[model samples]
Target: MSRTIPFHFVDVFAVAPLTGNSLAVVDGGGELALELMQNIAREFNQSETTFVLPATRPDADWKLRSFTPKGVEVFGAGGHNTLGAWWWLAAAGRLELGDGPTRFHQQIGDLVYPLAIWQSQGKLEKIIMRQEAPVAGRQLSNLGALATALGLNAEEIAADVVPCQVVSTGAAHLLVPIRDRQAVDRISPDAKQLFDLLNEVGGEGCYVFSLDPLQPGTTAYARFFNPTVGISEDPATGTAAGPLAAHLVAHGLAQPGVIKVEQGTTLGRTSIIEVGVDAGSVSVSGRGIVVASGAFSI
Candidate 1:
């Protein structure tokens, strides 16, 4: 006989429904096998699917296992992945949220990330994650070659902006600043070359952005491509967003405050990822709206 398990469909980094990065949250999976988890994640074929099990550690409330569509288990504190699970839990009453600061520890593959979720009148006000200090990684000095790989000419490369560089909070993402919105939108990088280049630089993917944003008050409008990890373009990449925010602050492009980021426009799913940076760690926060929920039998 097949067992039925509860699952939730979530849209992270979007205020409205049906617009944001997608996450499939599987509830009550303490007994599920790793191979089964990979199959389930592949079945969902979302950017990432999470299996939430009872916490083994006393400090953690829940243990999360993240899997990409490539059928590989990922080890890290995924920003939207973590928030989306809790969002559904709070919405479904699995987690009791009081009108105060609630500290929760999320265990992912033996790694724990401290998260603070604020609630007001039983509504989630903010979700903040304390990430590791930003680490400056390999820098790409070849602007012309980079521009060509990103489907742009050398002339379109923004000379006034900072050079292409890699930054990591949890994951390393190459940050490339373009001249304007038009240039950013015009980017259609060669998939094979981008994947190879990112691998060459020890980066998971590349985040190409433009300071001139379509939305007001946004620090930048960006797009993340990671064909190497099986993600063509991410709607809202919280992991990379943190590094990007840190890069901006370190390079004197943005102040150490709440910086807004708009992403996923090209895919029709507009995502807003808020990043907070100060003298230490970076906090990436966003709202995850429950789009659908049901049970899966396997």
Candidate 2:
């Protein structure tokens, strides 16, 4: 017998239907095999595809597992994949959201984190998730090799602004500060070289950014690339954005508050991510648009 699975497409951090990072959410996926889930993720071919499963623990309301197009199971709760999953949950009438902020727990990997959904007169306004505290990891020592891998001159990498380092809010990723947004946009990473560097540093992805943002009031303009997981580029990445915000605050480049990072302009997606950092805690908040829904028979 064949199984018919329902799924929805959400544009995370989007103001419009086609903008932001696209995510495919598979509903009622508790019983789906892991290999089948990976296959479904590949079929969707989005930056990330999420599967909604029943909560395995009492402290959690639901369980979410996300997989990349390359079949890598993403465990971090700080990314757009998990955010979009909960957005669909509330929008689909699965969760009872009272007016104002409602707290819910989500289980991703071995941990359960609290997430908040803000509602005004029963309308879901935004979803905010508190990520793990920031951890400033290894600093990339080879700017020359990194510059060549990114197809830029060594001088383009602005080590003076902030040293190229690996930081984690939920997942570890390399943060490369460029001189300006122009050089940030000019990045053309050699997949093999970039992958090797990331592997050596134990980073999952690379986030190249600059202080000059296209939008006013935004702190940074950035792009995401993860050859390790086969994501060539991501329009919006909450996991990376959260870490970047915390990193800036650690460097005194940004104060503790809601810092907005503008991303996806180079890819024409254009996403604005609001990251809040206060007293060592980091959170990412955004609204997602449910663009489409359908059933997959397999």
Worst 10 residues of 1 by lDDT: 72-81
Q: Write the per-residue lDDT of candidate 1 for residues 68-159, one digit (tens) a residue.
A: 89986666564677778877777888776789878888887777789877899878887787777899998887777788789998777664
Q: Write the per-residue lDDT of candidate 2 for residues 173-282, one digit (tens) a residue.
A: 99999999999999999999999999989899999999989999999999999999999999999999999999999999999999999989899899999999999999
Specify the poorest-scoring 10-residue window by lDDT in model 2: 70-79
Off by over 4 Å in 2: none
Backbone collisions counted per model: 0, 0
Question: Which one is best on lDDT?
Answer: 2
Off by over 4 Å in 1: none
Candidate 2 whole-model C-alpha lDDT, 0 to 1: 0.94
